[model samples]
Target chain A: MTLYERLGGEPAFQAAVDDFYRRMLTDERVSRFFDNVDMDGQIAKQKAFLTYVTGGPAAYTGKDMRKAHEHLWSKGLGDEHVDVVIEHLGATLIDLGAKAEDVAEVAELAESVRKDVLGR
Target chain B: MNPDRTARPAEPSSAIHLKGRTIPLAAGESVLEGLERAGIEAPSGCRAGTCCKCMLQGEDPPAMSQRSLRPTLRAQGFFLACQAYPIGTLELSSGEAPEPIDTVIQSVEAVAPDVARILLRPEDSFAFRPGQYLDVLHPSGALRSYSIASLPSDQVLELHVRRIANGLVSSWIHEQNEGQRVQIRGPFGQCFHVADDEQKRLLLVGAGTGLAPLLGIARDALEQGHKGSIKLVHGGLQPDRLYMRPQLSELAETWPNLEVEHCVLREATEQEHEGPLDQVAIRLAGSLENTRAFLCGDAEIVRLLQRSLFLAGISSAEMFADPFSPASP
Candidate 1:
């Protein structure tokens, strides 16, 4: 089956992301970043990101992530931040209801990219 | 606007709602037409099949192009944009490549400001060990790979998305149809599943949407109720730009063994610090013993983390990652 097919298409993905972030806000460890973030915008961007990447009708034709993030990186995006991002992602999948095998595959992918995301 | 009440679309595959960024391509039009339409200045050494520098991804797979891909690879779905014509909706990911890894888009959604959280699964069922990636099927047919954000054990899949201006997919996503469809495919590269489980602590790093895959790892660790302590470092711009905070906070709230530290590179109206990811790496120095690191996100940030980790005495084998960006042009 196609990846889209395997994911149960758009709804499944939407639900998964919703479940993913809902868990983030209350997590004492990483919720600080979202202390005053806009709730609706967060939902829209999250959904748009998923819709665009997963081949749903949506397209993420916004600013490049690097440059958009350049401002933040310039401020601070160290190994610690990256770790929090990764851990949250894992929890998201579980909440969104991903299989354990799928979750494991995601963790493995994160480790390989540490240098690029948090390295010099 | 009435939703679900709006008639369910018929022939979703054939009728694609054009976003503002779409380029109109006519017959005999080169695959480059879509690039030009999206205003992406693709780097093309040979617009023909020779140099292959122009080799960008197309709107969708089954898109045939020249160069970059061998016939066998093409048979598997890789294509050269310059040599190919526009088929349907063209997607360009990774400036050059075979389709990066074999993949097909699973779903799409816009969860927050300028961020689209995509949940993708590989099309080919090609085995990825974990912590690895398949190039994201960028609309212009570019192979932009992202780490698998969700873990293998988790039933659902996930990807973090923070918008990029002028970025074909990012911009289009920031402005368009909430339910539109896209095309993505892959399960490329390797992974970082720790078989030994000997390490007592797991360190994961992510910046912005880079946290997509790390969510997979932490969730799994928490599920097994593994005794190892999990420390996560997450960073982003202003609080409005904080992605995945809800989920991370909840986990930290409930789990005693998991600790996630949150930082911001951008305060509401001001920028601060050199870079949080690097900052985390600095603090992690010498404390790297018996810890496995999984990192993903924007390329520059990942590179910074990798170097720091190695210098901190973290073994190359113990560290794993999938760089999210590299300007090919």
Candidate 2:
């Protein structure tokens, strides 16, 4: 089975996405980035993005990362903000009982888009 | 024709003097891009400045954007080619050439089931910094890079070779006998002990044989009389894989400021804990306010730690890393 299947597919992905945002929105270092964002809409878009990227049936129809995060840079988004998000994502995956190797794989996938997200 | 008269005016372009070659740079082009345009293959990774692979020393220092450079390096005018944009004429040095050295294997012993520690005696002129790596050329012409695990004071080269299944160079290294001759080219990489401030705490973390360079660095730091505390965290897949446990423990006993922690991924034994190496290291050493971290290990672990440590208040410039990727045979 693929890592997505072992992670319990849609249900697990949903749980992880929800928990990840919950932790990220409360992180003082990164919460400010989401002050003006619509939490509900952002969460939905994130769910689809994670689902597609992790090999689920869903396809992400949102904007590309560079376009999606272009405005955030003006708000002082930087490498530290990206690091905080990745930490929360890893914590969420481990909290949801994913295997160590599986968590590492997912983290790497998230890290691959860092440059585009940072618009570097 | 008049001696002062020129047939045509010189085109306006930024000039870069590198290794006796002058290359023209267009507007908004990075040094690396300009070099590549001139058919120069500069070592680089992630072009975003997260990786320091494209480092070069030069005069007329360009403004640095990345925080990966050490303060000492910045003062010395070392900059990353991928990030440095030259505004005027610049003089940069090319990457150093690797010198080939012939050495005789003094001993090869199994430190773990799949890990062998090979000691070599090189020619009298051979020298290398702790945490640097060397490329080993096998009899079959296959080459592999391994970090130098011995300090400069040792006057000998040491390598920790992980026996990859069916790997050409690794298998050859494991089967080699004492007094066997081998060809190596090296002493590359910049992730060594700098001794910038002897009072700054040292946090050295590695996984598996990644501990090789870290061991050398820790020893170098102590030899240099660094007054701050030094912590070495070595993690592996299992307890038995923490190969230098006895040696590191002995060093810790004699060095009052040095502490060694052994960790395992799962099934923690009484002596070792079950956790990731980065997390375990952070938990043991609270508050990295003034710490200089030297990281070498699995690429994924190194990346994870780089992000985590940067978020935990450690400046990116203070952390030096050598991420290891498996070489294909």
Provide the overall lDDT of each model, using Cα atoms, as 2-decimal numbers. Answer: 0.56, 0.78
- The whole-model C-alpha lDDT of candidate 2 against the native structure comes to 0.78
| Per-residue alpha-carbon lDDT of candidate 2 for residues B203-248, written as tens digits (9 for 90 to 100) | 9988988899999889988988999999998898889888968899
Residue by residue across A1-120, what tens digits does model 1's lDDT show?
433336665556645555545556556565555543444345445554443333344333334333324445554666777676567766765665556776566666555555554433
Poorly placed runs, candidate 2 (over 4 Å): A1-120, B1-55, B58-68, B71-96
* lDDT, residue B199, model 2: 93
Best by TM-score: 2
DockQ of each: 0.02, 0.04
Q: Indicate the residue-level lDDT of B195 in model 2.
A: 71
Docking class of 1: incorrect
Candidate 1 per-residue C-alpha lDDT over B227-296 given as tens digits, one digit per residue, 9 for 90 to 100? 7778877767656666666777798899887887665665633322334666654584337777777776
Cα lDDT of candidate 1 equals: 0.56
Instruction: Please give each candidate's TM-score.
Output: 0.44, 0.61
**Candidate 2 TM-score over all chains jointly:** 0.61
Assess the local accuracy of residue B178 in candidate 1 as a C-alpha lDDT between 0 and 100.
33
Q: How well is each residue in A12-113 modelled by candidate 2, as lDDT tens digits?
A: 665566666667766889877766454334665676556555555443332467888899999888888888877777777778777777767877877877
RMSD after CA superposition, every candidate: 22.2, 13.5
Name the regions of candidate 1 deviating beyond 4 angstroms.
A1-120, B1-112, B120-130, B138-140, B152-156, B173-181, B266-276, B281-286, B327-329
